[model samples]
Target chain A: MDAGVIPISNTQLALSVILVLITGVISAALRLELLKPLLWGTVRTYLQLTLIGYALTYIFNINNLILIIVIISLMCLVASRTAVRGSPRAGRYSMLLGFFSLWTSTFLVGTIVMVLIISPEPWYSARIAIPIFGMILGNSMNGIALSLERLFSEVKSKISEIEALLSFGASPWESVRDCVKEALRAGMTPTINSLMVVGLVSLPGMMTGQILAGADPQQASRPLPVVVMLMIAAAVAIGCLMLVLLYYKKLFTKEDAIAHYV
Target chain B: MPEFFKFDQIEYHMGAAGRTVKVSSDLEEGSILVIKGPSGAGKTTLLRILARLLECDKGQVFLQGQNWLSFTPQLWRSKINYLAQKPAVFNGTVLDNLKKPFALKIKKDMFNLDEAIDGLRELSLNENLIHQDARTLSGGETARITLLRPILFKPNILLLDEPFASLDDNSARSVMEFLKRWLENETGRGIVMVTHNDIYKDISGIKIQELELSEPGVN
Candidate 1:
């Protein structure tokens, strides 16, 4: 197979460990105490990526749809757990809400990118599907976490204001409308900021990776980063919207009063 | 026939220990019901329950011969409003805060600038305050704005929790006078207030009854 990408040998890969040592040296000089974690992180990154590389090779060759789906679902599950864990104030049902939001958004956005845009063989190719879904999930996980954390904290802090709105005949949705808007804005800001600076202030990882793999700069810049960024934005928006709508109810009682615990 | 605004045997758990407080009372039209209780006696909780802002363990409220369940919570709250002890100032100008209630779908009334300016005057606030940022208002100004918000909405009953807690004596007197005038202005309106201040004693020509809440954890 005449793949344009040049493979890095084991020796060349081993040489990259020196870059981490440079970080370790800085940590030691500054007495930052991050050396141990940095070394451990380096080892884990090497091991995890190597293992995933082998797994991807096998999965890509096998091309089993069920395996691809299970893998995507597992990624979503881990993403949801990580997102919820970042938000300490998230309520008991937050895990469930996080998982549902991530899965739905990733699935919706991933399917659109795959079927409509990429249209890989058999329409569920593991090579394209996994990476795209993983990218969307990673970004949306941060967005959902930020949105949920903001929503919970904002609602708690603004309880009196929310109750005041309720007393003025506002519905539960109406009462927390401002809080929701703030949370949504918090969730969307990072992605929108990145959109503003893409290619100018920063070369995004996807575009850089494609260029490194010997794809034409113009071709790589045109569809890959643009589509991925848009997909991420959509996923983040949908995920935050779904999560907040589902979780805002937890801040209010069935009788439409602010929940005592909140 | 049911008396004008009545709550029967309202039960709520108070404090971390979850002690229950039972409250029951009624208010006549164009009258005032003063809730007297020491600190931690659950006076505010009782008012919140009446406003449907807190779910009572067991109780029923009837407004104008209709059970509270007969009305939606929004409609019930619109008719029976609760003013918190600490005023909630939204992020906007004072006029925007005053006009907030009218923006709700439940309130069909348009905001009256004349009435709002008049309310500011009655509370002894500068009329120009309406253009100021609500967050910049003094404590006394915030309290009066919060009080004026529901008054403009014209609820059937006003459940006030320490409405004069932040006001000076003169301002409190002006607020009391405004509330007295407000109670007398409509046929169906009434007030259920909790205040340690003695200004209610000066409110003449209005029937004033008192409901003293027993201390929490006391049988």
Candidate 2:
């Protein structure tokens, strides 16, 4: 085996398809009815990743600041849409709120990482900024989604208790304080748990990728994961906080009463 | 003089059919306004609207000559409290539930432990019940606790929705008596309650006015 990253040829990539074929065979044998989705998902994975791979290559060569920002903004928009899509109760207000939260938090953390920490030449280099922002955006998207979903569901389930507090003249913030706390906890729990068990439980994807791409294990294992983890933690916290703060207002009417839809 | 504790042209949609109910009424100082209606008549809705917990399609509420919009909802609610039919028993001890209101920034009054204990006594509840987990309280106990919670906050008007629904004859009678005394004890206080129970008729020495709500579009 070569020391540096060995490029996989089309023949080798075709050979990898056998693994999916084997999984498809098992699905057929068990009558699990998953073969259709399995094959479809494999195709989508290949197409999407190949497209992104080519796009990233072009993006890296261009490295224009405006282009990088536009791509990152587009990524944030798509991520925000996906984040709030699963939560039906989140309403239309959440889409805008989710987008703003994701954009703000990801950029805030991404700027810190790209400028002060990684300090890649040009600082906004597409190769560094796009991938780093992508990672932060992905994690923060999941966190915001989970927290927003939890916040809305908890508010729905605890409407009576919330109204009981409101009846005593508690402000909207006071009434939903407990629910907000629960939501923030829910949002951050996965990130915190990952922080606790990273490396021990599972090797993070970026570290493994770097190591495979010929970086030394020691170098791959240190600053990359540390900065990535810290960036994710910060982005997730800021995203979840912004989401709840903005979204909680939508749960009440102008009169401070629980909104009828809620 | 401006009418005390009045709501006019209060309208809200009820049920999936969107039947609209419009209500107009007032409560005199130190009196009881018994809201009488069959089920689904928007009795609970009326109380909620008055409490500003639910918005009315069209209405204006006035307290002590001031419009509802003049005050913040928090201040409006603190002055005119609404107790739900199914009481909200929070986690922790009954005392914690009692003290919960005072923790609000809007509340200026301190939680009076002595008054709370006396309130429990007046409602025929055990003083020791204060230390028990509020979530473990029986339906009747929960109802009384919720009622006591708003009273301790000292709202000028109490909007009650079937407050005696969970209580038995004895508990119901005692609660009614306590409410009667509560009204007479304060010069400016009043109650606008929704109750199908006839127990309020038995209480003497306080003026009780009745507002009967008919089904929407029927009358």
Off by over 4 Å in 1: A1-40, B216-219
lDDT of 2 by residue, B1-219 (tens): 888888888888998989999788888998999998888888998888888888889989999889999998898899999998886778899999999999999875599999999999999889999999998888888889989999999999999998888899889999998998898887889999999899977777868999999977542
Candidate 1 lDDT by residue in tens digits, B96-182: 899988888897568898999988888878999989999998888888999999998889999999898988898898888888899
Per-chain TM-score of chain A in candidate 1 equals: 0.89
TM-score (all chains, Cα) for each model: 0.92, 0.95
Per-residue alpha-carbon lDDT of model 2 for A96-157, expressed as tens digits?
99999999999998998999999988999898898799899999999999999899889989
Error of 2 at A103 (Å): 0.6
Question: In model 1 chain A, where is the ten-residue run with the lowest total lDDT?
Answer: A85-94
DockQ of each: 0.81, 0.89
Candidate 1 chain B lDDT trough over 10 residues, lowest sum: B210-219
What interface RMSD do all candidates show, one decimal each? 0.7, 0.7
